[model samples]
Target: MPGILGHRASLPRQLAFRFLPDGTDDAAVEWTYHDLAEHAAAVATGLLRRELTGHRVVLALDPGLHYIAALFGIFQAGATAVPSFPPTGKRALARFLSIVEDCAPDVIIADTRLADRVAQFEAELPASAARPHWMFVDDDWFRRAAGARRPDGDTRATVRTDGPALLQYTSGSTGDPKGIVLTHDNLVSNCRALEANMGYEPDRVGCTWLPPYHDMGLMGTIMLAVHGGWPLVLMPPAYFVQRPYRWLKAVTDHKVTISVGPNFAFDICTSSITDEELATLDLSSLRQVFCGSEPVSRATLDAFRDRFGPRGYDETSLIPCYGLAEATLYVSGKRTGSAVKTVWLDKAALENGRVRHLTAEDAEDAEAADAGRAARIVSCGEVAEGHEVIVVDPGERRQAEPGRVGEIWVRGPNVATGYLGKPELTAATFTARLADPGDELTYLRTGDLGFLHEGELCVTGRLKDLVVIAGRNLYPQDIEHSVRSAHEKLRGAAVFSVPGESGEELVVVTEFRGTARQLAEEIDAVRDAVTAAVTAGHGVAPADVHFAPVGAISMTTSGKVRRDATRKAYVQGTLKKLTPAADALPLSVR
Candidate 1:
């Protein structure tokens, strides 16, 4: 809180949070530096009336200034904050309860819009089960906060640095949501590290369409603005989903310097926008477009730059980053103002744990002759100043060579403590040391595969999702990219591994917009082309190519494909497959 409200000697005195509800607007709700402290103080006093001190409180509010103030208020009241995706459906409510059970929160704060769903969820819990008290944001609460007998600013003067700040739950892509208990020190450390790595400027205006519930959205943009003393414009992820142009227009309208989002968002802006819609976007003011939260795609960056370069968007503004919720949302990022780096390599050599740079002739021949498609790896960036990013050979319990692929391990002051209520799992994942007797640093195994090139971090794929066939190790992302590039039908699809008679095989699961009846022959063509493109790209044909309904392919709240559960559903024959009758379709993992 010191960095947020106080210590503003050299920082800019600007608006704290500007709430942009949608993409197009004539005006927005603004809170200046003084306004934020006063409102946050009032919000904290309201929490005290609910007796939330030292208790775990769930925040399920929509993305806005209220949510930002509520977060700081939770800290002011000494309550452990647990931000969750606002329950939107039956499935979402079930997962929301799962998080509640894991964190054991006492109070849940949400918008009045979600009162019905919250009430229904509470009624369904067993008599003996734990249920959190719901505190909806109604008109009365606003009045109470505005007239609150405000708490003293010095009340949290002695807050412990190691005290639990919040529990950031995983998105449940690999498994059910697991809570990571991060301390105050962890949050401050990571935020400061981001400020340093990103070359923070107090005068810079920040913007983000990321949802507040996710780690990158919560800590990276919203909190970073407060802690670093900068102005910020906030918008909802739903708005961006509906109108991708609004995201860029806000940056243009506000002259934003730093903005954050994943790679797919860039792809959507490039592909989904119409010629008329693209005409309104002006991104010349954007300095750094922090691309992260999933695998960074080189093609996505290239497409976005090529599409918008005419509108004064600098190609160097696109900065690739890599990190996870476990590390407080930032591990490594490229230097500010540097051009992005991408390397072309031989696909076969990539599978054998080596990076053999592809010459211009080799790349052209691969693309033209169909002998093999060259693999393009984008460097996330050089490691942060105070953080150590290592490539470890999980099998040999040692560090991998400079150019060899291995599991990514990280160690820094920014790393969070172990997951909540899971001592054994925490030790196994969060506290691992190298086999060398002289080293004592404990690194968090990222469960991701990558290598170091010229001291830059190069991410390949997830270890659990890595596919091995015929003595070759293949990254599913490489295959997924090939399928998507081969045809538009496979865009935004997922590739995973399944058990095979030989070793492990590839499974491509995706959703097609049209029905079997509407698509007819085109659907059949897509199936054959999917198998063929994968064979040419990876040197092995997919065991099966699944086409399900638009919503059948489940994703986490933050939009990561749930490959493990997808594979399990495919094995159990539960996916609602289309283009072929379910029982008639011939599909098997082995």
Candidate 2:
């Protein structure tokens, strides 16, 4: 139940905090536990003088030492910290403002670079409403606020274990974003659980390049390193996107022992790295490559191991993990030194609620006949030490048999209480129940579709209409179902979710009984109709719509459309399709 500041008082004062090995920025940013405590006290005093207590304070800034200081300062002031990304465009900016309006934060501590943009957006607001006071994180502000005064020695204040510690907004892949309320106890419990599960030591060195706005980046990389008293190397997300090889080079250069990212990052690095860059790097110190944030692919992992093995990378370093913001950070992870295990199954049988593991020979034969494409699913390993996982049926009343797909439910001291400000939704999601009839416990519904296979969790899909593309979620069913109802021929049509270089997109593929001559016109008509429907329904535009002849759409033996298969085929350029119009409408059109 103790807050981060409370722990800091008891933690070692001389523990190493962070290391900046890039040598690009000249910022002398290094702090010990004592320095952190002093800076947090200064920040707390500044906020109290401004009459900002027991209110939400948004932290909208880039990653830096000042950002870290301000984050702890907000917590020390007994206020909820809302960590958010910088607004990129008009729509994103509007959404950010809306969230602030709803939360009614007392103040905002933002970077100087975004102060003008925030002011311009605020000016557009209607009159007669309370507006958040803003303060810029400039050099003058830091000198004034951090050097002004300190909290009274006799005033003893601290956050309870049940008090809100953070307000993390959902990715907004669905409708509007919801604020996930995380308490001090929830974070402390999860961090301890992760430490015990992964066997983290103070001597370990962590390196990561994921954006700080994400949950994995904030909790897994930053909080874990700080709480464990380990030295950490930080890299911007842009640096990884621009040159992925630099990430590997950093690992070898710094002798990083632990790293994590999505599966796409590995695939990109493996496919794009040059032989010359690989020759100069030494990766022998790399002990764990934590893979998560998306579906873990065995092909991607194997390819990475093969590509970097000769470069001193260990084959057993790849560890697939599973976690979400609802549980703070981690749920499960494979053992440290074990090679990833995958089971080859008959694709047809899997769709019919039956799972049969196949022999290696049978797997090879199927791949050979299908031009070297096999169905290999990897396990996410066992649940963390203090956490419990259960596979439950739709009624939420009974557990499913092994190998039978169902919703994944989690229960533990680390599970969060509920969403912020939505009591009905909170009651619906965080339910009270026991695994056994007489056991006293409760579980949180994850809304993730998966099943237990030999005591390992195998995630298949999502129960919600959430589409995850390139490690981001997208809501397409709401748009697709609306589109279908708008056009008569498209009724009951299937909407396919696809990710491109830009981002995740929605593709409405409708089947119609028509000849090639009429297909072109029908396709255009359907595209226009669906585009309008989605724009009106969701305020977002569809990327494209392709019309297919009756029976042209691929389906499983049981007649369910293989949406994943369809997406893969489209990405590989193997899907036969009707011709698109020469003058296709732009994405902004309604």
- The digit string of per-residue lDDT tens for model 1 on 319-377 reads 78899988988988888888898877887888998878887778878867864678878
Please tell me which predicted candidate would have the highest TM-score against the true structure: 1
Whole-model Cα lDDT of every candidate shown, in order: 0.79, 0.68
Span of ten consecutive residues with least summed lDDT in model 1? 581-590
Angstrom error at residue 557, model 1: 3.0
All candidates: TM-score:
0.93, 0.76
**Candidate 2 per-residue lDDT over residues 71-147, each given as its tens digit:** 77777777788877656555446556666765667887777777667658677655654688886775567667655
